[model samples]
Target: MRCLTIAGLLFLCYVTQGVKHFRLGRGKGGNLGAPGGYSGEKLPPAQWFKQRLDHSSPSDLRTWKQRYFVNDSFYDFNKQGPVFLMIGGEGPADPRWMVKGAWIDYAKKFNALCINLEHRYYGESHPTEDISVKNLQYLSSYQALADLANFITAMNNKYKLQRSVRWIAFGGSYPGSLAAWLRLKYPHLVYAAVSSSGPLLAKVNFMEYYEVVVDALREKTGGEDCVTELKSAHNQITAMMQTHPHIVEKEFRVCKPFEGASENDIKNFYNSIADDFADLVQYNEDNRISADVKYKNLTINTVCNMLTSPGSEPAYKKLAAFNSIILEKSNQTCLDYSYDNMIKELRNMSWGSEGARQWMYQTCTEFGFYQTSSGEIEVFGNQFNLDFFIQQCEDVFGKKYNADFVQASAEWTNSNYGALDIATTRVVFVHGSVDPWHALGITKTQDNDAPAIYIKGTAHCANMYPRSENDSSDLIEARVEIEQYLAGWLGLP
Candidate 1:
């Protein structure tokens, strides 16, 4: 789950009493990722609430049902206790986060109320009947933040918390960026924030994404042999796309033949394979499953072993087998190599359609986080550049979203939300050393209050996962330090 990290705020500073700032960093002494949190129990139900469609624009009076999950089992309404809120990510709102996250563990110990709020336009929070470019005008981070601010006010009024409750925000990936921005934009509203894997900067090209991906491969495995094989495999496909287009079609078993395929088509084919590996490494924990897999514990290391195995020789065969296995899990008989369909789905905006259009709009307009492999390193966010992005914007959202306008928007986003020049207090930035997103995040503390930390060799949002016996010692220490900070902030002694 990921979304644009933007928002607005009101002055609630004098409304509270004791909200302290926390400055914390990482624990240095272990491997990168830990096992995914194991659970076999059914969690609680989700409670939906009516949220304004555009809190930022008063003229556009529309409302949508925003989905939220709560665990007040530990809360005492009679007493003003802390609220551990999980800000939802790009995808649908999952109540499982309440149990899968670290906050629930903290909730029981601290007698806190745990809640997870779904982002607008994602999950069941569909504002309009359809997600046309015209309808999505209100789907910016600015509106989402306003929605959050208004939601807080409404929830407080409904529960009668006197607007003085301790509110601690938590999120990972894009949501992590939102958590940090929430505190920055609405300092008076949010008491504190724990932003894990939050990319703070807004840029058109995000090449460092792959740099870290390559680094993750080497660091996690303690060698470059695996990476070397992967790179070789990737290059082999590129060569095949050029010389033997027929073979490329036959082996990849694409929905359509590779004959007369444009430059974009070939690049997209490569991306299909590239993104699969990326999801594996990004969520590179033993218990973490691949993006689309029925295999319970499919992992990057295991996949890498398969790619480099003695029998899996020749890059084409390895790629074909890998694709076959992953697609078969979803009953996909043949790979859908239709970028045109990809474009169509990106615009469908239906409940079931992937949220590609919205995310692409965000990239073209707000942050050009395009993953071009040609940059410094090549792994994640690769295979494209500004030209392709510009063309896609025009095709997707009309002419207003040109490169000049997008570049300017990116600059303004950084300036407004403290992308490059962010100044803040009462927030701790958490990152994994091998996470590509951290290239934009605050890994190094510029100010005393905003201390960025890294769990060495870990992947994206690794610390955000629930603690397990298999968790690295460094991750355990990282969580402990975070708890200490939160406890001290709320004056829990």
Candidate 2:
């Protein structure tokens, strides 16, 4: 026993020593470029261009605030292989939070630099003044693409990358929309892109998506319970609103579920509420729950903090603030189910028009709080409770509101900026069937000349097909598509 114990101690010491030695050796290699080759040459200058880093850069020391014109924000970086520039959505630009965990691991696998550049007015990338409707107009997609272009030029000069370095601009959700736009705007700057669950087609149907959510929930939960409960809650809430109009109209006018919510509002309500749950289920089937479950309410605390902040105690100031904003912007509603235009589109089952209308309503509302004029918000008040929900949207947008200014924004969206057309660049779009935002991802009705990957049961962005558990046949096929496409671009083995 004593001998065995001694041997055990020796083995433990041996393993510990090996680990320490390995770490020390890693340290001596001077940390840039792919791992595993120790040629004993003196480390290259800090600016030396390496395809991948020998080891990941220290996350703590890596974050530094960089200025681009009026905007200032901290940037996190992985100083390795071909740099992957990740443009985030409309929210704060902490790449760590936005891309979830997939990016960190992906950096290691590809031996590429991972850079998270925060969008202007988001996180540390704030402009000199608070955001409001008047100034919010500047946050247009065109302006953002310019910012990205500038940032890339700055980084290239600072690092003195060997020649024109290959970069991959990628993102999902709002950022995904931005990614597609950026690729079109600056193809030379971006070698390749992967826009997951991105909504490029701005003219999408917001209300029908509520229906999709309902169908998805019913399909996943295996019951009318969720549908029944949600519908009941919705009807009860709507009827309660009619009775206590003040409570809804003045105090808590939240963004109504897609479609001004019909007598079948209950059914519509359940679908909207269940959509996210269905997304989770489609991605993770092991934890499926009842149809009657309000998953958002359950994960509200966790999810809300990530998406928006719940203010104060007692009655919850955040909720109250949300109500106030919604009431103020209630005028700019969309063509609800009752509207002749909407009815016509529905009767024809016009997918494109419905999608465009929904996207317009939802995006405008979410973006409405930042509009510069009252007219814009008022125009779509019935369909979108812009004023009522502006505060809530503000919580997520991380900017101050300027109702008058933002109200003027309706025109730009209405006019349609620089015609949306086919791109000369190699744009790769991906989407999940279950996502409410899927309508926006549709570049064209039929597959266009550009490459696209739509995972059958997937949800948002890097979520549907998890990098960790993508052993299924469909996932494998998708992976092959990605690998082949990227390989062709990268000339990889």
Candidate 3:
């Protein structure tokens, strides 16, 4: 049996409750949406869910805040339009994604009541006081699903439309996984669901993430040359780390020099690179329309443009330019790409850390969604192996958390939740070819109602983004199919 150390557990708990917020970006605030940007649209009152500390235990009750955004502008309960529920994810529940999301467009057309519910442990929802491991016993998907079950009951009871109104679920990324799981777990609540780019599978190691990124970059450049050049550049950087470490500090412009840093710091510097394309692929949208891109068009196409376009700078310098782009996007000034800072960012939730503590806990305990790289395909591989994550558990939460315990947790999660053998109905698993997460999503289906729509050249939850004129025909079709599925399930004419 594996165990967690009390010291690490106490440290995590203390960090959760008392970590001070330090200024990082220009606005001195964390980025919620785009670079240095928030919805600016004020969030509504957060409703409380009479939640249980542990769904399994059910004895410990807590008033968990469920920060939900509602738009009833086009509601027609008289017409009996279904309720469109947008399940929130790993980050704070920003209503702008719902207000400006493609799901809302469907809601307006369907004359439905649009609702965006924040996930448990995210936004203002706190099942426990401090994010200590002991307190985090209730922070699993099962607990979150139970909270949704309660929310459904509450919403129905208040509205007095328990049997009269239909419910449809929609979400992107992690919430996308929740949306689908909700349907599978409680089909009675969610009549139908649209899981956009949801990573439904659980695994200890996910090296294919960077492989997909490289493949996407390859397609954009019309050849393997782009990936080749990047791999070569990253190889040189890694070699330089051992031979002439001073050059890395000068080249990367990192806040702290890595002249005498630990292995974690080296891994962090590599992670900084991996996160660049990882984010772009995860949130990419239509490349044709210039303005619809929320992330300043940080697409694979853009990366290829930067890498391929000729400059007088050397190859290493060009690679450094790519790193610069990610640093700028991070919105943190004077940020040392160090492991300590990474741990700080992960632990401190008050500092606008995007629910990382909560998510990392879940990842470490339940879903090991760690995105690593392979030496054969990616630029920096073996540097971010599974042991790196195991060490992370040792350093951050507790040294007692062994690989065996983590691996067992992942297996148990898959067994309880049905990762591969998930039996469900009326779920539209919409994913893109370019999305790295989609590799773990529901790829095939035996049921006619449960279909997986694969879009080409798109990335992440682009199909779920607010539709634009320049939106690809594939995305348009996927959205249409979702509407049709919901319509069929809800018995709408």
Candidate 4:
């Protein structure tokens, strides 16, 4: 996930049709006025709450308005039903989450209020004027948990529920980790949590991520030949970079020539190509009805078919041809893997920069989830390594964010969060076997209190999406099991 962000491969486009209407306070909500609305449901208007800037310091009185959405359509106000809080991730928090997702289904079943809280420095929840390294000190997971605590307390008082109402937190991917941590750090506030495809461990050199990608390729249909050809293609490209650099540039349709490119540029170029496969396997069939339709056809099986097609062309040529297909679909004129360009883009503190700069800062300070290809058995070559990513931290943020600092930061994160050894109860950790991020998540049952759901053939965050008719039986059963756990926790039959 971090690798895709670093390589600039993650597209930030959400396709929503029709007009979006916004209301200030909790009002009677209707349909989103869109044809593809989720069961003809509408997302509640955006709301704001003043949150503390520095939750650790008692003297600091500074505050900022954080964005959130509330949908109490299914709330059993007289009975004071449970509250389902969906934690936003590295990107902006879509209000649609308050109306859709499997959590909304659960909210309907339990007659609970659905609230979506935007993470600080993401979406409309800007805590500081700029994302400078000094300003980003308040953007850690510790502060985020504090935000959730304060928000929950404020909501409880606003609704006059006090301690009677139970709060169930939900999140996927990076937010998934935050959900679990929220329950661990503030168990009194969060009764139970659903952490789907959450990476619990903080690792510096995550070579296993790529190993899982190789494993997925080898296990899919026609994937055996695809894996062999992929390895050979990467070797060929590595050799050509050393001798015939011009040919490599021409074949890959690089935006800029590599005649005077820096070593980091070459490494980034390799990473951009490898990230294609990683992106495919990571998302796979996790596409829900609300997801971007552009990436629906791009899957593990689709790429494997292209790589294993019958032809006299060399494997490297076939690999380049596959990249062209991606370039066309993404509407990218040519590949731009310049290290300088990436640093320049990330240095911008404007809101238009989205959460890329903020997320990169988090990686440098807290989690070093660098997906390096150092393993010899990986289909992708060894051009990109831990040092490559660590250097970017120093280059983009500052000199103090070096390798030693990163190592200490990761160690501190694991130590503070308890990593996989977290002593929490009523937290269900759900993961897909094909999801590479599951390598760091808890897959086995830790105890009766902290059980894990390891879905066999699903991809990243598959259990969090809305139920689809085309879903595998394994996924349907997993959702049913999750419902059972939530029902028991909520004191329902």
Candidate 5:
């Protein structure tokens, strides 16, 4: 639900705002800071590291090349500076991260070498020939952590680095969890970790995700009126669907007529509309400078303004207008809420399956982060429940991946990783109050060693991005606290 497109899955899918996809720190070319002081004439090229296909199996000697990037522009060989490893998430590893991001800035100041490692099965780091269900068995967080451990060892050998040189892991979103877990699982390998907007807990019914969205709406200006209008609009749409189906179809501009649409199709339509709000809230005021100009300024304030705008037109019409705005900006003609079409897209086992199928597989097999609308007094109706998502898993993969299997998988993940009760030190957990993912993240500090920096009036991974004049004071202070923690761990002044 978090990192899925409507064509690929359901719930929180607005193309760009799919979970950790938007938090890649992608931006225009810029100059590298400090020691080497290189210009943006050429960014770091992608390098490949030979990784084991199955880290747990000694019999399986099969190996594959994993994509990665290295930026040693600020490395001080004489001083033996520390190393910063930025972990890639559910999306591709952008080379710009080597020169950009708050971590890169710290690397420059501390004269540390920077490296970005692409996760296996993501981007071009495929371990197998294809993404078939059998091949995907090797893809899991356990395997990914093993890859990092092996990679760090290989890097240490290649660079001939001393044991004093610290290794600080950095990641956002799912990779954020990886960063934290990397330190917890292999504390001897990783010196410290910065986990930003990382959800440590795995659960089947993530109804709290939508509740945070509603809270974010209320926190923004004119949000109360917008919430009222949105609830009224949903009721109106529901009534029209039962009485005049054609009117409902025309209002939302569905690709197919509602006359022959199945119950699943109707459910998909409601979920799609609800997802628009979820997407907006999840990534509100997050990395907007890199966003498209049309929607770059779009936020909860913008949506509230649109919904609360006074006019003779009904609330439902305003909601439709908002949907049309999104469609127009995305260059889409009609909203395709076809459940069958989604299944067809997910069933594609090709290499170019848009990262949706692979992420969905991870969700089904390991983390059951299905964002459902089963909460009481939810703005979005109860159309998207746990059953809806579980059915999707069965439809896309196989009947074997049913509710029982998913629940068991989630339990396994929590049992193996320790979930919210993860016992680790020198790990800084950073989260934004406005981001819905923060609900599953470590907002409060369990101890002094594992501190939490909960930034107010910010969105997902706000502190990870480069410094902006428009950033909130809390975000700026949070970054400072993170740097201090890293400095203390690295024995810096």
Candidate 6:
């Protein structure tokens, strides 16, 4: 059910063609009834199809094997006035799941049906598999997009939609990637989309992005001392590895179940320490007085917590396997065996890991240190060729992969979504300056056939917040343009 609005009351009778049409205020004895036209006249099947999209076959999900539970209430575009198929970002979050308090109030002003479809292998819709590195190959971005497009067509057929509907796609991070893809793939289906904090660029470079953070620290933090400490730690970690590869291996391999660092897993030690220091700074940016104390407390507490939380058994094993194959044996890794094919496989694995939803491709590559043949555990892609890193992931995780899907995705990334002609769609890309995934924003890249705006210091989807000066001015402009474009199209004021 939606809150009543002025726009809602006025669009009660307007009908679009080649799609299902919904008329407002139509209920029992109110000139409209269930399974009938909004006017309550004996509607023809043709008219019925005009009002709904049909998706009843199980084979619709043949490739994925998950059942599509159709909600009849969901099929009602008439009651809702118009349908706005809303797809969520990746993670365990279902597309049907709505964060009531999180959505923008202004965005909700549009009276439309919102359908949130979950990805194939997350939450209750999980596929029956070992759910380890073994079966992750099935969860590529392309496959996920296919699932969504198929559903949309099915719904259109099921409902007998009266007119070609307009989709305004919006998502942050991974789902943001999907949104950008959808707009590119189905230009006719989507009038516009808002991609927030999503990097359409694949074959990511971790060192490059982390360098941003490192540089940001160096520039903002007043200290050659802190820089010295950082550089010293790096040198120490690197030096410690040559003679102590096994020790480094043992430390990072075991997921700390408890709190403090029991062993000298240099990588784990640093990650734990970093998280604490970041938490302190993020939570209390205004409390500048005890910042140093907070940092010290975080270091002590994080180190202590590592001992308690050593990490899950399976996670440690998987991590260990990665270290063993890719880092410890880089020569035998995908690097030597089949370099070209390996890169394609790497990107696919990014989304198919243990908890696919939480995996941020860019951030993971940037932060998760991988072992190199030099006995160094470095971040995602240290060098320029991202495909090399992607291949490393596949080499590390022996999951079944789709050669076609990988190749296709690689090509798509190379062209920068040029296949979609992003310029053709009335697309609006939004991003936050401080967002970890901000690198995913479409700046310095082709607009995918549309316009883009970046917000400063905002996190993913933070642009939805009401006006605040600290908010992205560009984001504000993009929204205004989006509103204007929609208004012009719908003939609304």
Q: What's the distance in Å from true for residue 59, model 4?
A: 1.1
lDDT minimum window of 10 residues, candidate 4? 19-28
Per-model root-mean-square deviation over C-alphas: 8.9, 18.5, 6.4, 6.3, 5.0, 16.0
Q: Which ten residues in a row have the lowest lDDT in candidate 6?
A: 1-10
C-alpha-based local distance difference test score of model 2: 0.39
User: Which regions of candidate 4 fall more than 4 Å away from where they truly are?
Assistant: 2-40, 289-294, 376-378
Clashing pairs in 5: none
Tens-digit lDDT track of model 6 for 1-493: 0000100111121211110111010100111001101223221111111111112344443333432322233334664334454453333332222322112332355554455554555433454344444454444555556666777776767667656565566555556666778877777666666665555655333233444333333333433433344444445445555565454436433232223322222333343323222222221111111212323233212322332234453322332333333222112221111222222333343334323212323122222221121211232112223343344344444332223334444555547555323444565666655443455347543543466666543443444333444334565665576566555554456
Q: Write the per-residue lDDT of candidate 5 for residues 1-493, one digit (tens) a residue.
A: 2321100011122443122221111101110111112236457898999999998988989999999999988997777899999886676666666676688778987899998888888777888889888988998899999999999999999998999889999887788888999999999999999988888998888888878878888887634787888888898888888898788788878888988887787777887888777767776776423224567677889888888889888888989988877655554577888889877877888887546677778889888888788873457889878888898899989999999999999999999889999999999999988888888889999899999999987876777777777778898899899989988988887
Residue range 1-493, candidate 4, lDDT tens digits = 4311100012433322111110000000110101122565555788999999999999999999998888989987788889998886666666556666677788889999988887898767899998888899999889988999999999998988857689999877777888899999998899999988888999988888888778877766634787888988998888898899898889998888998999998888888888777766776776344234665677778778877789888888888988876666545677788888877876787776656677778888888888888864447878888899898898889999999999999999999989999889999999888888889899999799989999987877778766777678989999999999999999987
Candidate models: Cα lDDT each: 0.66, 0.39, 0.65, 0.76, 0.77, 0.38
Candidate 3 least-lDDT 10 residues: 1-10
Rank the candidate models, highest lDDT first.
Answer: 5, 4, 1, 3, 2, 6
lDDT of 3 by residue, 1-493 (tens): 0001000000011112122121110011111232112246554454555655566665655465556667777786566678988776665555455456566678877788877776776656666676776677777888878877878888888777748687888876667778889998998788888887777888778777777877788765688767767777788887888898788778777777787788888876776666665655554553222222344667677776776667665556777777766555544344366777667666553524435566667777887766776533446656777787777765666766678877888899888778857788788888788777777788666578688888877876666655667677877888787777777777765
Q: Residue-pair clashes per candidate, as listed?
A: 10, 56, 1, 0, 0, 62
TM-score of each: 0.87, 0.53, 0.87, 0.92, 0.92, 0.54
Error of 6 at 36 (Å): 40
Better of 1 and 5 by TM-score: 5
Candidate 5 TM-score, C-alpha based? 0.92
| Candidate 3 residue pairs in clash (backbone atoms < 3 Å) | 3-400
Give the per-residue lDDT digits (tens) of candidate 1, residues 225-266. Answer: 778777777677777766887776777667778776677765
